[model samples]
Target: MRDVLRIEDLVLKFRGYTGVTEVLHGISLNIRAGERVALVGESGSGKSVTARIVLGQLQELRSAQVQGGLYFEEQDLNRLSRRQWHALRGTHMSMIFQDPTSSLNPVFTIGVQFTEVLRRRDPKLSKEAAAKRAGELLNSVSIHDHARVLNAYPFQLSGGMNQRVAIAMALANHPSLLIADEPGTALDVTVQAQTLHLMHDLVERTGTAVLFISHNLGVVREFADRIYVIYRGRIVEQGPTQAVFENPRHAYTRALMAAVPRITGGGVPEIQDMDGAFFDPLEVHGEDRP
Candidate 1:
C-alpha cells in the first residue's frame, strides 16, 4: 500500500526573545494507506508539535521555524502555501484533538459544528442534507439519538458523548488520513475503551490511515498496527506493534513498557532515565532544552 503520510527528519524551532529553541531534532515516520500507526511518547516529547506541523498549524506562528520534509500523498507539505494548507487540512486530512469538549466550539450546537465539517467536502450541501449526513456519522459512532445530540451544545453533553461527536466530525469527510491526538483521554477507562473500539472499527471499515499520538502503551498495543517510540524529540525505535511489544530495543521503550501495571500485581517498575544522564535538581542553570 502507498504511504498516505511521511515525515523525513522533521525539525521544528521556535524563535523567542532569548534565542531559538528547537523541539524536534530529526524525527521521521510514515503511515501507509489504511494503516494505523502510533507515535508513543511522554509529554513534551515533540509528539504534538509533530502533529501540528503535519496539520500546518505551526506555520501560522511567525516565530516558528520548521525544516525538513513533511509529505502527504507524495506532495511536499513544507512547500504548501497558507491557502494550500487551508485547502488540504479538512478535505485530505483531519484531526481529533486531545480534549473533545475544549476542542469543540461551546458557542455552537453540535449540528451547526458538524454541518461545518461536512460542508468541507460539499460546499453546496444544504442544511437539511448536512443534518442527515451528520445523523449517519453520529450513528456510526454509536450515538443513536442523533437529533438530540446534534442540537445539544458541546458543554451540554458528557465527556464521552462529546468524544463520540468529535470522532464523528473528524471522520465526517472520510479523509484519507486521520490524526487522533489522544482522543477520549479525559473519559473514564471503560468509556475510552468503547470510544477507541468505535474509532478503530470506523477506520478499519473506511480504510483510512491513522496517525494515533498517545503515551498509553496498553491503548497503543490494542489499536496500532505499528508503533514508533519517541524520546526527547527523537525516534528511537519503531516496528510492527506486536514485535515492539515483545522486544523493545530502546531503553525508553523498555521503561515505558515496564511501567505498565500487570495483572500479576507487581507494582510499577522503576523507570530509569533512558540515557542515564543525571540532571542535578539543585542546579538552576540546565543544559539546552528540547
Candidate 2:
C-alpha cells in the first residue's frame, strides 16, 4: 500500500526554564492511503503532540522543538516553508481536535463557521453555493434540519452535534489525510458509536486515510484497520488491529488490552507495573529486558 503520511525518527521537545524535555522520543509511523490507523495511549503519552506535529501546528509553541522527518504525500513537513505549511493544512491534511467546544468559536453561529470554512477553501464560491454546501455537509454527518443547525450557535448544540459539525468542517475540503485526536471523548456511548461509524464511513467513501488517536481500545478495534500502541512517546507494538489485540507481543500492549473495560461478569484485572525497559519495535538491536 502507498504511504500517505510517514514519520521517521520523529522527536518533539519543549524547552523549559530548566532544560529541554523530550515528549516524543524517536517515534516512527506510516499511514497508508485509505487506511484507518489508531494511535492509542494514556493522557500525556505524546499522542496529541504527534498529531500536532503532523498537522504543522507545533510551530506555534515558542518553546517547542521538533526534529526528524515528517512526510505527507512525499513532502517533508519539517522542512516546509510557512506558505507551504499553510497551503497544505485544510487542503491536503485536516485535523479534528478532542474538544469541539474549544475549537469552535462561541461568538459565531454554526452556519457562519461552516460557510467561512467553505469560502476559505474556495474564495470564488458565491454565498449561495457555500451555504448549500454547508447544508449538505451537515446532512452528511446525519444532522437533519440543516437550516436550524446553521443558525444555532456552538453553545446551543449538544456535544455530539458540535463534534459532528467539527467533523464536517474538517472534511469541508475533502482532505486526503484526517487526523482525529480523541473525537468521541465528550460524547455518550450511543452518540460516540454513531459518530465513529459516520467518520469511518465518510473516510472510506472519500478514500481519505485516517490517523485516529484514542484511548478507547473497543472503539479502535471496531474502527481501525491497523493499530500503533504508544507508550511514553514510543511505539511499542504495531500491526493489524486484530493481531495486536488478540496476541499482543509487547508488555505495554498487553497491559493496555488488559485495562479495557469488559462485560459485567468480566472484572477489571490488576494492572502490572510499567517500570520495565521500554521496547522499540523499529529498533533492530535488542536491549536487555527489564
Candidate 3:
C-alpha cells in the first residue's frame, strides 16, 4: 500500500518566557493506505503532539515551531495555507480527540454537530438529508437510538455513548486518514473494548488509514499492524506489532511490555530502563517491519 501520511524528522517546540521547550526530537513515522499504526508512550512522551502536527493543528499556533516535512499524499502540509488546511481537515482527514467531551460541542445538540460534519463533505446537503445520514452513521457505530442521541447534548449522554457519537461524526465522511488519540480511554474497560472493535471494523471496511495514539500496549497489540515505541521525545523502537510484542528490542519497549497487567493477575514488573540505556534510537528493520 502507498503511504497516505509520512513524517520525516519532525521536531516540535514551544516558545515560552523561559525559552524554547523542545517536545518532539526529530521523530518520524508513517501510515500506509488502509493501514493501522500505533504510537505508544507514557504521558509527556509527545505521542499526541505528533498526531496534532500531522493534522496541521500546530501550524495554527504562533508560538509553536514545527520543523521537518509533513506529507499527506505527496503534498507538503507545511506549504498549505490556513484556509487550505481547513479545507482538507473534515473531508480528507479527521481526528477523534482523547476526550469525547472536549471534541464534541457542549452547547450544540449531537444532531446539529453531526449535520455540520456531514456538510463538510456535502455543502449542499439539506439538514433533513443530513439528519437521516447521521442516523445511519450512528447506527454503524452501534448507537441504535439515533433520534435520542441527535436530540441530546454531549453532557446528557453517557461517556461511552458520547464517544460513539464522536466516532460516528469522525467517520461520517469516510476520510482518507483518521487520527484517533487514546480513543475510548475515558470509558470502562468493557465499553472501551467494544468501542475499539466498532472503530476497527468501520475503518477497515472504509479503507481509512489510522494513526492510533495511545499509551496502552495491550490495545495497540490488538489494534495496530505496526508499533512505534516512544520515550521522552524520541522514537526508541518500531516494528510489526507481533514482532515488537514477541521480542521488544529496546529496554523501554521491554519494560513497557512487562509493565502491562496480565489477565491472570500476574505481578506487574518494575520498569527497568536501567541508567537510561534505551534512550538512544533502536531501529528495527527487514522482515520484522510492516
Candidate 4:
C-alpha cells in the first residue's frame, strides 16, 4: 500500500528570550493509506507538537522553526506557502482538536459553520446543498438528529455531542489524512470511548488514514493498527501495535505499558527505566519485530 504521510528526520524548535529550545529531535515516522497509527507519550513529549507541525499550524508562529521533511502523498509540506497550507487544510487534510468547544466557533450555529467548511472545498455549493451534505456527514458519525444538531451552537451541545459534530465536520471533505490530537480529552470516559468507537467505525468505512495522538495506552491499543512510542522528543520504539505491546523493546515503551492499570485489582505498578545508554542516537530508533 502507498503511504499517505511520511516524516523524515523532522525537528522542531522554539526561540524566545530564554534562547532556542529544541522539542523534536529528528523524528521519523509514516502512515500507510487507510491505516491507523498512534503516537503515544506523556505530556511535554512532543506528540501534540508533532501533530501541529503536520497541520502547518507551527508556521504561523514567528518564534517557531522547523527542519526536515514532512510529506503528504509525496508532497513536501515543509515547503508549502501559507496560501498553499490554507488550501490543503480541510479539503485534503483535517484535524480534530482535544476540545471541541474551543475549536468550534461559539457564536456560529453548527449548521452555519458546517456550511462554511463545505463551501470552502466547493465554492459553488449552495447553502441548502451544503446543509444536506452536512446532515449526511453527521449521519455517518451515527448522529441521527441531524437537523437539531445543525441548528445548535457549539455551546448548546454537550461535550460528546459537540465532539461528534466536530468529527463529522472534519470528515466532511473526505480528507486523505486525519490528525486527531487527544480528541477525547474533555469528555467523560463513556462518552470518550463512544466517540472513539464512532470515529473508528467511520474511518474504517471511509478508508481514511488516521494519525491518532494520545497518552492513553489502552485507547491506542484499541484504535491503532500500528503504534510509535515517543519519549523526550524522539521515537524510542515502533512497530505493529500488537507486537510492540506484547514485546516492548525500549525502556520507555515498557514503562508506559507497565503503567497501565489492570482490572484484576492490583495497584499501578512502578515504571522502571531499563539499563541502557540514553543518548545513543542509533539506540533511540529501535523497531520491534513483527
Candidate 5:
C-alpha cells in the first residue's frame, strides 16, 4: 500500500505574551492508501492539533509556528496556499469535527447546507441534482428518511442524528482522506459506537483512508488497524494495534492500556503516578532533543 499521508518531524508551537508553548513535538506518522490510523491519548495530548495541521487549518494562525513535512500524496501540504487548500479540502479531503453543532449551520435547512457543499465542487450542479446526491449520501450513512433529514435544521435533530448528518456531509464527495477529530465524543457510548461502525463501513466501501484522533483507547482499538500513542505532544508508541496492546514498550503506553476497565473483573485500578517517569525523552523514540 502506498502512503497517502506522511508527517516527519512535525512540530507545532503557539506564541503568547508569556512565551512560546510547544504543543506537538516532532511527531512522525503516516497513513497508507485506504488504511485506518488512530492517534490516541488523554485530553490535551495534541491529537486535535495534529489533525488540524493535517487538514491545513493551522496555517491561518499567525502566532502558530509549524515545522517539518506534511505530505499528502507526496505533495507538501504545508506549502499549499490557503486558496489551494480551499480547493482541496472538501472535494479531495474532508474533515469531521468533534461537535456537529459547530460544523453545521443552525439557521439553514440541512438540504440547503448540503446543497452548498455539493456545489462547492461542481458550481454548475443544479439544486435538484445536489439534493438528490445529498439524499443518496445520507442514505449511505444509514439515514433512511433522507427527505426529513434534508428538510430539518441541525438544531431540530438529536446530537447523534446531527453527527450522522455531519459524517454524511464529510463523506459526500468521497474524499481520498478523512480526518475525523474526536468525532464521536459528544454522543453517548452506544450511539458513538454505532456512528463509528457506520463510518468504518462507509470508508471500507469507498476505500477512503482515515485519520482518527481520539482519547478513547477502546474506540481506537476497535476502529484502527494501526495505533499511535501520543503523550504531551510526542508519539510514544506506534505499531499494529494488537502488538502495542499486547506488548507495550513505553511506560505511558502501558499506563494507557492499564487504564482501560475490564468488563468481567474488579473495580478500576488506580494508575500509579510514576513521578513523571514516563515523560522522559530517553524512553520514547519519536521525541526531539534540544
Candidate 6:
C-alpha cells in the first residue's frame, strides 16, 4: 500500500517571553492508505498538535513555529500555499475534535450545517441533493430520523449525537485522511464504543486512512492497526498495536499501560515516579527507529 501521509523530523515550537518551548520534537511517522494509526500520549504530549499541523491548521497561530517535512500524497504540506492548503483541508484531509459543543455552530440546525459541508465539497449540488447526501451520511453513522436531526439545532442534540453529526461532516467529502483528536472523549463508554466502531467501519469501507490521537490506550488497542507512543512531543515507541501493547519498550509506555484498569482481579498496578520520566524525550531508538 502507498503511504498517504508522512512526517519526517517534524517539530513544533511555541515562542514566549521565556524563550522557545518545543512541543513536538522531531517526530516521524507514516500512515499508509486505508490504515488506522493511533497516537497515544498524555494531555500535553503534542498528539493534537501533530494532527492540527497535518490538517494545515497550525499556520494561524502566531506563536507557533512549525519545521521539518509533512507530506500528504507526495505533496509537501509545509510548502503548500495558503489557498492550496485551504482547498485541501476538509476536501482531502479533515479533523474531528474532542468536543462537539464548541466545534458545532449553536445557531445553525444540524441539517443546515451538514448540507453546508456537503455543498462545500460539491458546490454545484442542489439543496435536495445535499439534503439527500446528508441524510445518507447520517444514516451511515447509524443516526435515525434524519429529517428531525436536519431541522434540529446543534444545542438541541446530545453531545453523542452532535459528535455523530460531526463525524458525518468530516467524512462528507470522502477525505483521504481523517485526523480524530480524542473524538469521543466527552461521551459515555457505550456511546464512545459505538461511535468508534462506526468510524472504523466507515473508514474501512471508504478506504480512508485515520490518524487517531487519544490518551485511551484500550481504545487504541481495539481500533488502531499500528500505535505510536508520544511523550513530550517525540515518539518514544511505535509498532504494531499488539507488539506495542504486549511489549512496551519505553518506561512511559509501560506507565500508560499500568494506568489502564485491570479487569482480571486486582486493580491497576502501582506505578512509581512516572511523572519525571516523561518530562524529557527518551532516546530509546537512538536515531535508528524512524
* Candidate 6 structure quality by residue, lDDT tens digits, 145-252: 999999999888898999899999999999999999999999999999989999999999999999999888889999999999998889989999999888887777
For each candidate, the alpha-carbon lDDT, in order, equals 0.88, 0.85, 0.87, 0.89, 0.87, 0.86
**How well does model 5 score by local distance difference test?**
0.87
Ranking by lDDT: 4, 1, 3, 5, 6, 2
For model 1, residues 1-290, the per-residue Cα lDDT tens digits are: 79999999888899999999989999999999999999998778888899999999998999999899988999998788999999887888999998899999999999999889888889999999999999999999999998999999999999999999999998888899999999878999999999999999999999999999998889999999999988788998999999999988776787677655578964444444557753221121222222
Segments in model 2 whose C-alpha atoms lie over 4 Å from true places: 265-290
Shift in Å, residue 24, candidate 4: 0.5
TM-score of 6: 0.91
User: Which portions of model 3 miss their true places by more than 4 Å?
Assistant: 263-290
Each prediction's total of clashing residue pairs, residues at least 3 apart in sequence or on different chains, is 0, 0, 0, 0, 0, 0
Q: Mind giving the per-residue lDDT tens digits that candidate 5 earns over 173-253?
A: 889899999998899999998899999999999999999998778888889999998989999889998898889887787
TM-scores for every candidate against the unseen true structure: 0.92, 0.91, 0.92, 0.92, 0.91, 0.91
Q: Which segments of model 5 are wrong by more than 4 Å?
A: 264-290
Candidate 4's residue-wise lDDT over 89-148, tens digit each? 998999999998999999999999999999879999998999899988988878899999
- Flag clash pairs in model 3: none
Q: RMSDs, each prediction?
A: 4.2, 5.4, 5.7, 5.3, 5.2, 5.6
Q: Per-residue lDDT tens digits of candidate 3, residues 1-290?
A: 68999999999999999999999999988899999999998888898889888888887899999999889988999899999999999889999988888789999999899989999989999999999999999999988998999999999999999888888889999999999999988899998999999999999899999999998887999999999988879999999999999988778887666555567964444444657543222121111111
Locate the minimum summed-lDDT window of 10 residues in model 5: 280-289
